[model samples]
Target: MQTTGISYSETSVRGRSRPSSFRQRFKHSASWLKGVAVALTLGSLLSGCGVVNHMIYKTTGDVMQGFSRDHTIPYLMASGDLAMGCAMSEATAPLLMSFGRVTNEPDQLAVMLYLSAGGCAEEQGREHELAALAAMYERKGNAAEDAIIRQKRAYSLAAKRYLKGWQHHNTYYGEPGTGECPDFDDDMDEFIYFAGLLAGLQALNSEIQSTSSIGVPKNVGSVVARASSCLESDKWWGAPMALKATVWAMIPGAQPEGEDAFERLAMTDRMGDEAGVRLSHVFHAIAATNKGDEAMVKSVVRQHAESLKEQPANEDWAFVDAMATNMIIAISDRLWVENTGHRTPLGRLGTFWDDQKAEVETMDLDGLL
Candidate 1:
């Protein structure tokens, strides 16, 4: 209803090279509306609510299968596809890069480039440029100093260009803090939340770890704070709430209020309440990572496990299962590290628990005890 109210049927001739008369435009609009009416009538007559319900059941069943070792690649790939499918343009590249690419989507290229510029990749093409700046700062020569300054200028200019271009072409939320984020014009808040989280996380990971020059610790920290505020205000119903909570847990010293937003939803006992169930895992993960109260984490996870076990597994439930399973594994790994020097009660956590070394090597993160 909110989205429908905001939908202003734009004149078809507006974006065209040749303009049309008001009468012609009105006729075209009428034809389009008539076609929509016919399509809806045919759809309702053919299937009814049963058909719609069945489709909903199928979609839910598919989404609830979370990530496990056997399906890590597939899960990540599918999440990537969904992210890209929902993305309207290149401005959303920061989030798109979270999952690796499959095909050559045009929007993906800019996302990749942004990552390269920020040193998100190992062999980024822009690494040479970054290194050149480093070399200039390292030496005592005029040309070298000039080169470093020029490189800095170039990077800044490119970023400004991208921001301006995104503002001009993007139909969704424009650059944050342009007074564009608060506008309730559409149901694309999911996309907005995803993008904001991606950007905020990018800034945090890069700046906090000292891997990037563009983001400073103070700046990244503030970004996280802002993101948490945005996420809280956004219209997250289920899994989106769990996902946002998971990201919020990663923010250092972040303690946002309204942790009970998901509970307000009148979710049925069906696995369609995946967000509610999946949130338990996030709570556990937060408690594990931050070395917070263990009792609270265990209580949430156990509560959900008991409830979820009673629910029927629908296709959409797969997404919830994957998310919960991954969170459990992550929490277990954290517990092992904290309790027994990275040794689990089951066994030495081997490949599954060895994220520390991988994260260090891949992201250049400091592995603090």
Candidate 2:
């Protein structure tokens, strides 16, 4: 009775209700929705492949290398635990070398690997230099004719290792026409580039300290000057500035008009503070030491200590942070070995041993003997 007349909403064909046709259309729509969802899922995965690969490579390299520097080596070095540091370096050497060997094509990761390898070589050179210093100290009072010979030999070995380090770093950048210098889209490229420059600087320092006649290449300075401009706007402003300051201080009459090297060194502190990396302090201290400016050295060292106290933790770039700490500690180690026959005091590596004195005091061995 209620359906005596067909409702306007109902479709009829040949006196038959078309409810089945509606069902068929609904089914077709459901299939189309499913296909659309599958297509979207595939598209998302395809679009994310490059990003995923990049992340994987970056994370792997950082974690492996960072752990070696931050957790294993620096702590060992700081605590005067060289045995373990050497062991760790040896164990990791093969793995690090493998990265270089596997890559025939130049890439960002390749550059990082080379830089890390160069760092390893540089550290080895430093160990030799320390050994030579210790040898000199051993013959401090005795008239040992052979002491000079031994020290010279050690210095020569150190210089060779440093040269090797420089060569490894030069593989990525610095050479006029040889290096790949591949473009990268992240902070790592900057870090690697800066590291290369640092290697060149260290190589030059090693040669000078060893009294070697080997001259620094003219192109090294040119490359550093050109590359530093790129780092000025990033978190690494302090690094390039420090490099410039170092170059100015080292080269005879190289300082530009109205530009003071010491001031440039000081400016790095603020930039480093903002970026949470104080490696510039190391460069500052080294340059000051080379100039025999004890006052400036102490000031920078004190500032470094205070900065460490303020930020005791390294939340990012642990490797670099640890390297900075290691370098500062090494400075303290040198002072202590020459004066006190020990490494730095437990927690006073960066601070001046005596604030009233501009120069480090040597021990009076006459009374102790």
Candidate 3:
């Protein structure tokens, strides 16, 4: 009886040991699973930060792009302050451009901004050109050479900015006049397209002026000339025809026989004036300057000034009129500076330093004093 009791006790002990071993194995597995879960959670958190950052950056980029297209561009277009416009473009370009990393680039805005910035640099180049010319007139050989170098440097910078604008325009719109002009999303889109053409033309012009190999396409002039036809000359305030005409006048063999470039420019000048947008005068002056026809440039500037006096600027397009005025003034200033070693005097845009003084009886100022 004692032996049997001992055997039962042994069986009970074995059964208890089996359960204890099973519990130990289950506890170990649970602990392993917990550790794996913690590791995965930490890993996911570290990686998820990048994903979250990407999303946030993309959203911000999109918002900025939208705001620029909807509000900023229109405001700048409507404002007549060319200097302010230039400043705005230069100041905001880097911040705006950096957003391209996480989102689509604001290419249309880039076209306008770079174009404006290039204009600012071109203005500086013009100043240098005037200084160089004045130095030559004064027989200051070293000064003239130095001024020329400065002018070329400014022009090279202008060319690079303008070419960047042209590149962005091409990337956004594809080659202008691709199968046909791409359907413009709106009037603003059409305007942007027009701006792009101007950018390309300016790029080529500035590159030539720089006397540097800027890689601006030599064919850009012809391309712009052809692309100008895509815009309605009348609808865009005669700018398109003026651009085409300027290109025709500038490029060799570009003007179709019997279709006189100057004649077309004259017609467009009238069209521009009648439309209350005097942009055509700019083209006329540019063509005349390129031809070295100082008389014609003077005539164009005089006509523009007279037109301003006769007609109130179109309220809706006042900014464009103001831009034309600014460019004309720049040209007039160039002439004045070339002759007098200074820019045009206040309220003397139409008159030159050499203009004949109207016959006046000499007042004896000494006796009066």
Q: Estimate each model's TM-score.
A: 0.36, 0.61, 0.84
Candidate 3, 1-369: lDDT as tens digits: 245532221325534644456667999999999999999999999889989999999999999988998788887777777788889889999999899989998898899889988988998998898898788778889999999999999999999999999999999988975557877898889988988998899999999999999999988988898888889998987889999999999988999888899988999998888888899999999999999999999999999988888887776567678888988998998898778777888987777777877888888889988
TM-score of 2: 0.61
Q: Residues 1-369, candidate 2: write the lDDT tens digits.
A: 376654444576666756666778999999999999999999899779867876776666566555653444344434433344445544665665454433332333333333444445445555554554565667653333344444445445444544554565556454623334546455555666666666566656656555665555645654565556656634674878887787778677767899998888888876776666777888788889879887787677778778877865345554565677677777767666665555667877665445445668799999997
Worst 10 residues of 1 by lDDT: 261-270
Q: What local lDDT does model 1 show for residue 27?
A: 93
Clashes of 1: 17
Candidate 1 residue lDDT tens string, 63-130:
32122212432333234232232232334444333332322222223332343233222112133344
The root-mean-square deviation over C-alpha atoms between each candidate and the true structure, in angstroms, is: 23.3, 17.0, 6.8
In terms of lDDT, model 1 sits at 0.40
Best candidate, TM-score: 3
lDDT of 1 at 65: 19
Q: Native-vs-model 2 lDDT?
A: 0.61
- Please report how far candidate 1 places residue 127 from its true position, in Å: 26
Which is better, 1 or 2, measured by TM-score?
2
lDDT of 2 at 154: 47
How big is the positional error of residue 216 in model 3, measured in Å on the Cα after superposition? 0.8
Off by over 4 Å in 3: 1-43, 358-369
Best by lDDT: 3
